[model samples]
Target: MTNFLERLKSPGDLKCLSLGELKQLAAEIRERIVETVSRNGGHLASSLGVVELTIALHRVLETPRDQIVWDVGHQAYAHKLLTGRLDRFDTLRRLNGISGFPRRSESPYDSFGAGHASTSISAALGMAAARDTMGGSEKVVAVIGDGSLTGGLAFEGLNQAGALKKDLIVVLNDNEMSISPNVGALASFLSRKMTSERFVRFRTGTKLLLGRIPRFGPGLLGIVQRAEGSLKGFLTPGKLFEAFGFEYVGPLDGHSLEDLIETLENVKRLKGPVLLHVLTKKGKGYPFAEESPALFHGVGPFDRATGMVKPSRERADTYTTVFGNTLVEMAEKDERIVAITAAMTDGTGLTEFARRFPGRFYDVGIAEQHAVTFAAGLSCRGLRPVVAIYSTFLQRAYDNILSDVCLQNLPIAFALDRGGLVGEDGPTHHGAFDLSFLRPMPNLAFMVPRNEEELRRAMVTAISHDGPFMFRYPRARSEGLPLNGTPEPVPIGRGETLRGGVDGVIFAVGSMIREALAAAERLEMEGIRLGVVDPRFVKPLDRELLVGAARRAALVVTVEENVLQGGFGSAVMELLEEEGLMARMLRIGLPDRYIEHGSRSELHAACGLDADGIARRIRKVVGADTPVACTPRARFTRG
Candidate 1:
């Protein structure tokens, strides 16, 4: 009941607490986590699950010297609290506050930066190798979840770490799920090893039998370990790890503080690569989270007492919902249409699609590279596969997209969701580079939808197109328009002018259209009349239309949600240069630097991409002073 969490300033302070007190600290930590997360909205369940493990590790090891790398870093809230960040914990995920994930630049205790999963092992191994080279003795450990192991990179790190035979400790935190339930062969193997009753009995009996063999029991057991390797392999999950040259140590009780501290102390003294397999509940302390961990995985704010999220008054559907609904509708009409996601069935809004047509749905289990190439394979067999993934995650499969899809000119529909500043997920998840990276690939058509209608139209256009096609939508809600259900194909390389003016023109794309129009409305009050154009396609650049618009206006401005470098604005400038038309131009978008965590509106304002910011920038381009008294028309909301 005492404020133990407030008193503890550093990991060194944890050394003074008794096992009972440490257990108490774990409870307090979980309470604090739930309280903060209920208001702030963050990765809650994972953080709650790892409280004990986090305490145990800090208790047993000397941190800041002994490195602890967390895979994905979403579950390190307890670690953050113990390491001098408790005071700022309230500001988690807010703009300019402490990050939800680990950042090496933010704190020295954070040994490595992580937002995405499955890179912990490699980073820890590298640190271990570096320590060895310098002739130093600081323990290095990587705490990885079972879900993170689903990635190929984790195994790649394991392979190299095993071969190197360096002193490294890997903590495999088995929570039976990632963001969603675990899938694939690795999940099956871990599950089989954990649940086999016969294997558990046999393993226990063999160890007891070996202990009873007089004076020679210990030495003989050690020597014949490999001779009995087959039997042990059949009986334990750790046999696979043993083969990789690691000293396999667990199947431990992760919730028991005494057992965890004791086991970690033992493993800390061992030499060479060691792996301690820990079993923990995904949402341990909280009952509601325990019942449905997936819903609480990366949750929005909720009522702490009832665990119920307040009903949102937003009547509009998000872009993801529209995509999912449209995809199912289209699939009903076209039997050849199939959907794919990389273990993000619910997050990607394919839950309805999966329930309606299970056979046509494929969840690839966090393997984006495989998802893209697999979609290509599906295309080869005359089936149309649409890969719906977050723009940030899709960066992982760029090679496959370029080689297997674009190079081959396959009919794969790439539906990129979360295509702009994803807010609280931060720089790691912001889709700032997709336009720049995706523009150069040959035989690819790029489109950014202005609203729900345009998104549906683009979806239809992408599905019907012969070559590789990409359409991106932001992470916010749609325009709340009534359903038309008709799929109209937008003419390629052409822009539609929404408002006409003689002084200047504003070219807007995707989510920025509403803001651009609002800025134009504000500027009109000051006698600065500006025209607006919606260039639906980013790749084709709409050369003729854009050049003609630029030539007529004294000033031209391009607005997008993407970064300035090699973005839609760059495409517009290059087109103007080609036609030898020189005009005063300004590009309004995200800055070259990585945008930090915040609400989308706050980030938009910070980056000068919001309506007021855009209006000021436009007024500066022309020689018009700010209006003294003006009532701009009702703000332009998307139709």
Candidate 2:
């Protein structure tokens, strides 16, 4: 409704605005976020929800110098808009515009870069300790949500912060949510706020309270002091945090700017660590978000006028939807099958599974370590535990996956959703490295499906197997190939030829099957018949199929949507070496660096992994076998 966004160049500019104008500014920011996000697409509800809080932090604290580290950093969109990036906001999350999350390189205000969750406290503590070491005096505050508080890393940070006794501030942004509703012990404790109170026991103990009584004698004070030890316990419920050795404040009104600003300034002075528990409504300015905040948490492009998001119809079914439907169907037949997620039920497509088997489904907050170990514990009790989690978040539980599940060699199914590049959310959200990490783990089986039908089959195969297994799929929606049939298990550790020829060979995995097929067709048109193989399992490579494919062609190329170093292609290279199928080889995948933010299609095309890139690589690798046009680089490489 207004161009107030132009007037705001930085958080520093807001100092002169009255509280009412500040509140209005919060609305304008939310409006701009909704308007832009509805076209560009981004984390909608979380940004809307944090409007006033972001404003209050800037309004109260000295940033960059003071250091405000946002947990997860997805909610930092408002912070970005306020901190001199509003003019460049159109480039938000686009390649080399401005990142969706805080990047130290992007601006002076972004004190730290973050995309992962539950890491703010430790980061802030580090900065504080650095400040102490440099003898520079500046406030370092960590803004963490209640959802993040559930993660073990956050607690690890909290525990260490308590022991370090640094002058650090941890703002517990408790809307009681972390993608899904917040779960775990800390959230439950924060919600039952201020029902208990404690008397300021004097510097000593109960003796002081009784000693202060005008008529009490010293002899009687001794007896009362002994009783008071147990008496104080009855009144004060949780010094759970105070036990960790820090002053605890709030469970205050987070929306009231005056209260927030005043309370923050007051705690800003208190010595040692302090937790200000500020409660605010998520989706504060938007009515639709207020009504169903979870759905709006990370929204797609939508109509701002009616609050209706346009649906994606490029493909028949999303990979997540297929996975969720398969799990639901399996859970229906098998009573022992259980599900686990790290605070992502709907996002992982386990909503139906959770709804159908509420008793069996465990949404373990943001604690990925706990979820893995918890599933392992369930497996010990003869339950078939399927952990439905995103690929990126799973990186957090590497230790848990190794020590808890893989070490035991239990029959746990790791349903890794969003297993490839997740567009726009950027590098932190990309599912590019699960292959490299999981492949080397002992007793772990890794695989991916070519399409939805194969995914259904893979699910059945995973459930039927007796040891730990993992299956990953892309974030892109399925190619719309119908299920066409019921659940059927494909043989474990086996892959088959999708198409075959004698020219150069292309071995692909997961969603790359489509790319492989497209590349093959392009080659065929150019009189270079290419062989295509889908090695459904990246681990335990289809030895016979791979060797046969290698022998038939003069050159071999392995394709995957993962990092090139020690990934699926590397596995194929090892196979070729062992078999002595010394055909010239080429590798195509992500490089040994962080891929920047952009639309998946744009990144794919630029990296030369799309249909055309794959076809060209195939042509270059098979230069001697078939005469083909080549670029100067390709010609030199071939020569």
Candidate 3:
């Protein structure tokens, strides 16, 4: 058989293919996705689930002219394949390659960029409004998942889109899975197994039957129409969307290209906002993905045949694993310690904790804003609530964190995972701004742990603290250091001297400490003595240690994994200025631009956060000729 996928140049090419040919093309797309993802690693199950839906949409709609905004964009792999990116599909999620999510700059066909969820409907509505204003004849559609509907943002968008009644089509792809199995009332509502198409056809046929029965039929038909609204509400999921001022249609098979194409063609001509509910499996084609959809939701490179992930060289426990184990251990001792996550039970390392303390655990779906305020409410009721969320996702609840938690001085412990340069997912998923944003918030204690043991202690300290506390950790594996005794809370606003030197001092935060120690060791070999200090808390500086180190040294360096602007480095600079220290200072961190997707080590090296990069920068500043081999170690004198 000829390769149908190879013949496709653009979405317009799908228009020429017959229905049988389209089904063949979908199989080819799935094969290509599985082959590429097996080597490159990406969102596997979600993409496979939406292959037919993507192909049908492309076949029916004139894209670039007719905009289709995809929610989250992880499931857009099939969309990417159909839309002129077939050749570049192998480069998915690689450094300097095509993005894993939709990017507007990469292609005109990608109407809007998306990485985060629940923004598609709002974005598509804006595009529809723009098209109306410009008097353009373009159609606008927002392809959102049932899981994304759990977020409040999707409802907010729906509320506005319904009010305006714009010429838009919102396709709700009901696969019943996000990162995990979806939660909350919205999931239950969408999961109702009522056949909406059968009911809709019955309603249509009854209306025609009633209209044809002379004078008495008109009055009877009017009464039945009014009663039909109530009957439809009781029988189908469409009632909820119909109440939102949208013309509700379907509960149709998303895998059926003919049905999808026909429905999409009919809906394209309709005025005002219309919603098409499409039912699809999370992993449609691949048997491995279909069996375990959540595991394959976002995956690493794996064995195509066995579905086993490729093992890394580093066999140490991941920071996520350590955090999960530690949290479970702590929760067992304290009943008041309740955990809350925004639909990230597995991702945030809280799976075991949830299992152990089922009543105390809460997965609040994709609503981050609600999760923060809800944790605050739990704290107010005298519970030690720990909000376990990714650093990037927590940015959505900044206001809730500042006003509801910080301003109220609630004792909420925030366990921020993925605190540094997250690999492969790119700028949207990078936790580069947490330090900068959270630093200025009052009544909040911020901690950064250097190793797995420190992470355990930090968790203990944050839970025990009176005010709101937050600690951030990276996405990498933990240092294989053995955990000693029970975790003990370290002294707040204090730092420890790892290596002592007279030439200069390097204040390193979190994962950067490892790089700092390596750089110090390399400099020591070069006859340049550079001290390394682990400043545990970013908000509360170890004033005495820092001042004394600055007084004795001619040069000082601050290193972090966050963006340079308003970050840990900036905090150190402000401190030195306040103390009136006369030391030449250097800051090493990510630059004030979005870093591209790559391995954590690659990103660290690119941003000069790696040990070799750190050493090269220090050597440039101190001059390569300076010999400090005979210099005495600077003794840290406490104030």
Candidate 4:
């Protein structure tokens, strides 16, 4: 047989292929995805699961004209292959490479960009509405996973689509799993396999037979339809979608090319909000992925044959691991402590906690907004709730964090993981704005931990405080220092001087402290003396220490991993200005623009946040161009 994948130039080529050829192409696509992801480290199981469904959709629909918005675009790797990206497939998620998720700027086939979940339906509906306004006949479809359906935003889109009564298609990809096994009533509802093919055939046959009857055929059909509504409400999971004014289709086999293509070809002609329920297995073709779908959902590069992840060069425990262990230890001593995650039990390092204290753990689905308020409610009942969420995902619940938690001064501890430039996943997943946004909020204490030990102490402080407290940590490994003693609550709004210098001072936050220290050491060798200060709390800043440091040093610099605007650097600048300090100052951080996807080291260097970059900037600012004889090292101080 010929190589269908290599010969296929675009989605239009799929229309010319036979069903057998399409199946072969799917096999080839899976091979390509597995090979690439095995090397590149991407969303494996989700992409592999959607191979057949992607082919079927591209085959039937006139893509580039007919829009298909994919929810949480990780599952659209097959879609990327089917589009004109096969040549560049190897570069997925790499710096200056094709994105892991659908990017509108990258291709015309990608109607809308997606990295986050539950936005597809609304975007597709908006496209459909625009098409209607312009009187265009283009078909709009949204392929959403059962997991994404659990988000409240998906339902909001559904509610609006039902009322507008536009011609739209919604492909419900029921794989029965999200990143973690899905939770909530919607997951349970979609899991009911009551609407089988046999039931569908029987219902169709009965309707046809009744229509064939004499003059009373119409009356008999009406009675059967009314009865069927009640019956479907009891038997099928699609009654909820139907009640939302959609014409519900079968729960068809998503992997069956013939069934998918035929059903899609027929459904394309239907009008007014049609939902096609297609059942699929997560990690369908890959054996290893199928066995542990969640593990492979968003994985690093691994051995494709043995299904083992490749070992990293860094041997230290990740900040996430430390957080999980510390939380579990803390929970052991306190019964009022409870943990909550918005469907990221494994990612947020809460799996062991959930197992150890099942009753106190809550996986609130992909509902961050609800998770915040729900934690607030839990706190109201005298329970200590720790809402663990990725910094980027927590942005979705900013309003809730402000109103429900901060404004009310609730004692809820928010552990924001992935608090800096998360490599590979890119701009959509980067946690660069947490400090900028949370800094100005009232009645909230925000802290950035420099290492695993500091993170443990920050956790203790957050829990001990009687108000809304949030702390952020990076996605990288912790500094290999031993986690020696029991964590204790540190004084709030305090900073410690790490190294003392006479010429200049550098105030660094969180992960940037390492780079700052390195930069200071390098400057010392070049006859320049610099001091480093770790401002633990960004919110209740140590004004006295900061003002005193500024008064002593000729030049003061602020560095952080977040964007420069409204970030840690800005906060320092504000403090210095208010104290009437006239020291020459420079701020180093992420650029004002959205950062592109790249390795953390590369991104840090690019944004001048690395040791060398920081040194160069400081030298340039202080007008120190020539290197002289080495000077004595600055005095090292802990506090």
What TM-scores do the predictions have?
0.90, 0.89, 0.92, 0.92
* Tens digits of per-residue lDDT for model 3, 327-360: 8888889888999998888899898888988999
Q: How far in Å is the alpha carbon of 339 misplaced in model 4?
A: 0.5
Segments of candidate 3 deviating more than 4 angstroms:
177-222, 624-639
Deviation from native of the Cα of residue 140 in model 2, angstroms = 0.4
Q: Model 1: clashing residue pairs?
A: none
Please give me the total number of clashing residue pairs in predicted model 2: 0
User: Runs in model 1 with CA error above 4 Å?
Assistant: 177-223, 227-231, 624-639
Q: How many residue pairs clash in each candidate?
A: 0, 0, 0, 0
Least well predicted 10-residue stretch by lDDT in candidate 1? 625-634
Give the CA lDDT, 0 to 100, for residue 85 in model 3.
91
Candidate numbers sorted by lDDT from highest down? 4, 3, 1, 2
lDDT of 3 at 45: 97
Tens digits of per-residue lDDT for model 2 on 267-327? 6766688877777777778888788778888877888778888988694888899999988
**Worst 10-residue stretch by lDDT in candidate 2?**
630-639
Model 2 / residue 98 / CA error / Å: 1.9
lDDT of 2: 0.81
Candidate of highest lDDT: 4
